[model samples]
Target: MSATAAERQFDELASLYEDVAPWPFRRDIEVPSVLHSLGDLTRSDVLDFGCGAGLSSRLLAGRGARRVVGHDASEGMLSAARQREAKEQRGIEYVSRLTPELEQRFDLVLAVCVLPYASTRSELRQMCASMARVLRPGGRLLALPLHPDHAPDPDYYAPYGLRLVSDTPHAEGGALRVELRAAGVEADVTAWYWSRNSIEEALRDAGFGPVFWADPWPPGLARVEDAPPALHAYLRRPHAAMLDCRRARVSG
Candidate 1:
């Protein structure tokens, strides 16, 4: 399978990504919210878009999803995911992408940290539309796109395994590049900034709404005590945002 630029970047970073995500974004926020919101997945079909090494897919499958499909653009990441599925025997189906031929639709779709990889406005629009297409009407989408309000500052996120390596202005808007580092592991990733207006516009055009921005301290936080103390302050300020949206139902 051909790799997207973002996919190749992730492929090189996949091993380290399993160990060190950008901290608060993954551990303190997105993951907790996703698992909490999916309270009763007993018979739900779940899609983990950009499933990476399949961490979210396995989590959803074990939590009683009737079917869990992990779709990613990187073959390396999918290979690792399939290896784990082989060992664990979880009924997860990993694919490079959701094709037109696949008639199945999901009840819930989780796209944590997937949007910022889009380098262009049209790419982002296509992604949002593609996600909408795979969801059954009334299906829910949880998207964690990077916050346009918070472009990286030097030393701002150093405590959380991320360092602002560079920033440059683009015709599209602001862009920030950062390096994820921890204990002898390092990987460079770029996150494109999209205004809230553009993001909401894309979702609305894709037939999803009324989109709701999730609260930083979701009710799920009360159950997780392992989050580091430093996260509390950052939570109050928006570094990234969770967009909770539902596909609109068509009228008969």
Candidate 2:
């Protein structure tokens, strides 16, 4: 399959991207938040839309999802994911394309850091449509996209081992340079900025119902007041936001 610009970039950064799994913010905040929002995966079939190294895909399988299919355009990332599946035998399937038989076959689509790869409004709508096509009616989509209200300061997320810089931070379809750093490993990727209104419109036009912006909270923490200083600060201005929406059920 031909690679998109984002896919090619990730193909080169595959190893470093896998290294990001253990980073504090991702391990402590992002993963748990997304998983919690996805409660009770038992017997569910899930699509991990941007399943780099199959991190979330493995998690879904461990959580008792009957089947997990990871789809990505980066062969480099898929190679790493397949190696893990070979060893662990988690029964997770990784592919570069979604076939006809897979259409409307999943109960959920877990799209971590996938939507912002769309550099245009049309691309964003197409991405949403792809997720919608693979989901059964009333199935859910859980995504993490760049927060429209994210702090523009390049250093704002430095404490979390992430940096986002944009010469045109407020402009729709503007490029955002994202840098991830941890344990002496660093990688950079490009994502586009889309306003919250634009995102909601795309989802709705793709046959999804109302969108819900869910707040991220650490798994073990009962309240935000209980979080430590650094965690609290990151939570207050997270660079990405969790979006939950469902496909509209067909009216008979």
Top candidate when judged by lDDT against the true structure: 2
**How well does candidate 2 match the true structure, expressed as C-alpha RMSD?**
1.3
lDDT of 1 by residue, 1-252 (tens): 356675577775567767865455567676666677778899899889889999889889889999999999988889899998899999999999788755338888988788888777887898898889899999999887776555346466666667654445222445567677766777778777787788889999999978888644555355334456777545655466778899999879
Task: Spell out the clash pairs found in candidate 2.
Answer: none
Q: Tell me model 1's lDDT, rounded to 2 decimals.
A: 0.76
RMSD of 1: 3.0
Candidate that scores best on TM-score: 2
